[model samples]
Target: MLRFQDWQENQREVFFPDTVAFKWQMIETFIDGEEYDRSHVITESKWLAEHVKQGEIGAQEEYKHYKFNFSGNGQIEVISNGFTVKM
Candidate 1:
């Protein structure tokens, strides 16, 4: 298992590049102390994408940042972390 600090640094260097740059102080991720695995980290969404601008289903107002939940397709509902919705 890689060190927690080491793995987190690598994740920041890898994922949010083009529109999102890797800023160690600016990143928020999950690193299970026992292991340094890619499967364990979580990346926060900026919610500044075009799909958000299209607006949400049945929503009367535009969303700046959202703490909404959607049940994904599957036998079990996947309730992901609340994400932001931006244009």
Candidate 2:
């Protein structure tokens, strides 16, 4: 599991607040790439399905496609088992 937090910066201080958080379980693959317009998770991913059909991945393994979007920065797309909301 990985934890990503959003922070605030000012003249007084640069601090991290537990406002918005991202917790991901990147069990299969992790890719940091350019921003994607699609901003959501794709369950029972076709992307992974293709790999499975092609014998790249085992049929026994289950994976989900997770896409995280940062305001201006590029996005990160990961193939994980699943994720939960921690608040």
Candidate 3:
């Protein structure tokens, strides 16, 4: 398993290699009054692509499946483990 620091470092490398102008925007949704929540880090396109790739890899490794659905208004839903996280 990747440590949180390692994952953050990887994200930094992927999103901001030489420039510091970009930053991660936290996108979160509260479920059940914040007892359960879903969150994502909004970054550059390359970084988001890598994030999705990692999610796909994790699903395959765990023998699970993921379904991603996008709506017309730029909302995304990632369905996995019988739950959906909107992004």
The TM-score values for the models, in the order shown, are 0.17, 0.44, 0.17
Alpha carbon lDDT of residue 47, candidate 2?
A: 69
Q: Write the per-residue lDDT of candidate 2 for residues 1-87, one digit (tens) a residue.
A: 434454343222112222122343333333354333334665556766776788766788655556765454445555655555443
Error of 3 at 38 (Å): 21
Q: Which candidate is the best by lDDT?
A: 2
**Cα-lDDT of candidate 2:** 0.50
For each of the candidates, the C-alpha root-mean-square deviation to the true structure, in angstroms, is: 14.4, 10.3, 14.1
The total of clashing pairs for model 2 equals 0
Model 3, range 1-87, lDDT digits (tens) per residue? 111222233421112112212222244332233222223333233433454576643423322222111121122322222332222
Which stretches of candidate 2 lie above 4 Å from their native place?
A: 1-39, 43-46, 84-87
Model 2 sits at a Cα RMSD from the real structure of: 10.3
Give the alpha carbon lDDT tens digit for every residue of 4-63 in model 1.
223234322112112211122222333244122222222233433333445432233222
Candidate 1, 38: how far from true, in Å? 1.7
Candidates 2 and 3 compared: the better one by lDDT is 2
TM-score of 1: 0.17
Clashes of each: 0, 0, 0
Worst 10 residues of 3 by lDDT: 12-21
